[model samples]
Target: MERSLAIGPGCRAAAAAAIGLTWLTVAPAAQPRAASPFRLHGTVEPIRSQLVTVPRLTGTGFGPLIIIHLAKPGTLVKAGESLVEGCRAAAAAAIGLTWLTVAPAAQPRAASPFRLHGTVEPIRSQLVTVPRLTGTGFGPLIIIHLAKPGTLVKAGESLVEFDRAAQIKTAHDREAEYRDFIAQISKRRADQIVARGRDETELVEAENAVKTAELDLLDKDLVAPIVAEKNTLILEEARAKVAQLRKTFDLKRRTEAAEVRILEIQRDRALNAWKHSEGNADKMRIASPLAGLVVLKTIWKQGSFGEVQEGEEVRPGMPILEVVDPSAMRVRARVNQADVTRVRVGQPVRVTLDSFPSRQFTGRLEQLSPIGSPSGLSNKVRTFIAVFSIDGSDPHVLPDLAAAVDVDVK
Candidate 1:
């Protein structure tokens, strides 16, 4: 039979305290142990296998085994492959922990890799640009004669000679005109002097006639009254004639001076034109700045683009040749943006000639462009230009030769 038992509050509290003590004593033993906080994630690289290390054990029942296993040549290893293994007791005594590293084994490469392709160029060069003949009033000139391509020239030598026929004719014509104007100016000066002298003489004569008429009016006091009045009118007429002559003389002098000035200006213009034409005609000859090998520049010709020839007619201020110093040589290379950061100025470099594969040259990285530019037609790819100055010169190491540059960079 089920029976209900009623207990007092003090008795119930004593029973609950007893149950709490039992749980507190057992909870500590029931929790799980914590996992390690440190873990490493990486791949196992196949390396030259080697022996493992073990320390001497004290009071141990078993001795550690030291095994040496070297992987075979061309061996490939996967991740998690055991490189070394040791007993926990031995590892802790030897290294406080257990890990060892070995470099990879070497294998035969199928082919040699290429670092970069570049072009050979001269280190020092002078571009024989078109002279500023146009600024000297000889614009739009045509090239009559030019030095042949690949011609070796010396300083002060004529590299290019322009056609000066038109300029020469203009100069001669202007000179002739200038001379004519000079002669006309001289004649005008003499004629002006003669006209001025004649005006002065007429002015003097009119003044003297007025004085004589005044004297006659004074004498008219002894003659009839009508005669005196007539004398006074005569004097007035003389004075009016003198005033008219003076005005006409001034007008004539001004006109003569203006004509002389006009003649002088024409002469000056003609003389300046003649001098400008002469100077331009002389500037038609372009001289070389230094002694070097001359290379012709390609220009737009009659219908197509080709090298500038002697017979080709070229305008003034057109570059027709480049003088390159072959002794000083260099290589221009374009390094991809991915590899540009690996290259630095003043670093040593090795260069190989494409034509002469056996020939290798040593040079220093002299220049590196800080800015990057798009390569070819692809805007997505960019490259930096690097210039290397060749250490020494070789006869076969000419400009425009294909080459390869090897840089030491990881």
Candidate 2:
């Protein structure tokens, strides 16, 4: 049985209001929405970059380098542009260069979906250093010339020049020694020829004497007994003299040949030394291998790390400068291990430089490291390196500039 109660207008209005409030609360929860994309931070850098270092001098007893010339920072340079000049001295000195901007290039169409943060670096780069010498004990190199930093340069241009006085002097000395040996060898050969001729004359005379003695022996039977005996003794003496001369002649020839050979060896050694010194002198000048911008490296100086200056001393193999090709640039970034799966190779990305937030560039994910490294925040957390290749060129998109990257994962 249904029980009907008396209804009032106010009760009906209050019941309708309660039903409306319940519907409002549940309606929004039933709808679907999209998720936010993950973003990564990185730095803008050329894909091609190089580090320059002080050339490690080859051989022993090389003194310290003294900088005589240095390029000013921020100067545009091309390949093979002179950047520094130096010479060897009792004290040491150094210089450095830093590559800055790159020319614009065509964009790559491939894209990736993830964002990562890293520094920009060039894919192709070259490190410039002093040329290693071929000769030993030549003192330190002194900088005689250097290319200005940031200058545009072409391939195979001079980047550094060192004082070649010592090398030149050494080469001259070696040449003199080599020539002296040559002269001595020539004289020895001439003397040996003269001595050999004399010995041959004596040997021929001895043989003739032996033949005469043998003829005398043939007539021994026709002479008196005592005379015949004397002839026999004379023949024996002649034969003995000839045999001795023959043996001595062979020994003398061998001895003379050996003496000449010794001189030749000495001459060859001196010639080699001379050639090495000359080659080393030529190597004192350093050249760039590719077209790019010059970048000076910072080195320890006066108790602080800074740019190397002229008239300073530097050791061999210390990094001094770099030539970077800036046409193509890429950003290297790190992604959290947990979020790495959200990103894939070839995903499209948007890059914005922190220095110029108003400027944005498009790129694609180029590479994702297979292994993860410690994140430094927590022992359990790891981060993977991600490389993003920028598609278009921006003059302001220089290396080492901090940048933010965004990817549309949806």
Candidate 3:
């Protein structure tokens, strides 16, 4: 039972051969490995965006604006939609309001091929603001009505309505002044006409008296010495009166013309002021220039920065809101200098939103920055900015969302 059997030399050789073949097959399989693709992080941003601000009025006294109504944030809108409304704090009543249209400039398309990180942005957007009033002094603007923020609107829709009371009142005052000036000018002209007629009659009478005096002088020689001297004196008096009347007529006409000219100038100034006020009143209401979503700007208020609200006063030139086109969005990404050369414009890439990992978008490189900035890691290293355009639309593909981009080097 304990007896052992010895292996032959041929059997040992065969076992060694089998082991070598298995090693060779496993080594080859382990030596070859697949490389991972390069990825860059970026943020979603609107390609076109405008800052909304209070308009700078040309004349003085427009200040301390009060918001009466405001649009709810995140509204989808078309071009010309109403966004915000305001009025003057001192306004007593509302007046007829009109809409103002804004237009965005066109953006040129570019291509990029790289993985980079950037912000989401609309390709086009516009800033909504209170309109500037020219040629008149208006009081502070007050918000009367505002479109809900983030509203979807079309062009020509009302965005904001400011209290038109101040503008309307100013217009009325200017109009009244203009009309009064017109009446004064007319009355003055009529008075001048009556005075001219009276003066002409007096002048003619004086001339006739001079002629009568000359004829009477011819008879002076036939009369007594005292009578002749008296006739000569009468003739001299008539000639002197005729010369005085003629000079007065010319002076009066010149003075009256100058007076009328002054009134006309005043009337023109009043007319211009009235027109400016009327236009300003219409401008009180702000409208969307393009179809997009409404975004309210964060502003400093009461020692902190926040979105503007109804009944809050805003100064001229202060930022208030924005209308952004959501359809066309892009991501601005920063790429390492070393990887910059690997990417080119027009290269296809995959974009994944960090907020929603499940959502992935296909896009292409739109642009690459020519210059590079110093990297955080080292001064010698640089990073370049690259823009990628998302191919299609998604409700969640809004601006400012963080995204990961995978560049297809192959």
Candidate closest to the true structure, highest lDDT:
3
RMSD of 3: 28.9
Tens digits of per-residue lDDT, candidate 2, 260-369, equal 89999999999999999999888877788899877778888678999755555555666667888888889989998767877889988898888898988898889999
Clashes of each: 0, 81, 87
Cα lDDT for residue 66, model 2? Answer: 62
Q: Per-prediction TM-score, please?
A: 0.64, 0.66, 0.65
lDDT by residue (tens digit), candidate 1, 1-410: 55444434445456756544222222456667697698899998745655445545555554555544443433454444445544455554543433444445356343332377889988777877665652344456566778887788888999888788977888999999999999998898898888889889988998999999988987776999999998899899999999999899888888988988898899999988899888878888988888878887777877888887665566656777888887788989898876776788987778999999999999878999998899887897789999988888787787788988887653
How many clashing residue pairs are found in candidate 3? 87
Candidate 2: which stretches are off by over 4 Å? 1-115, 224-227, 373-382
Candidate 3 TM-score, true structure as reference: 0.65
Once fitted onto the true fold, the runs of candidate 3 whose alpha carbons sit more than 4 angstroms away are: 1-114, 135-139, 224-230, 334-340, 369-385
Overall local distance difference test of candidate 3: 0.79
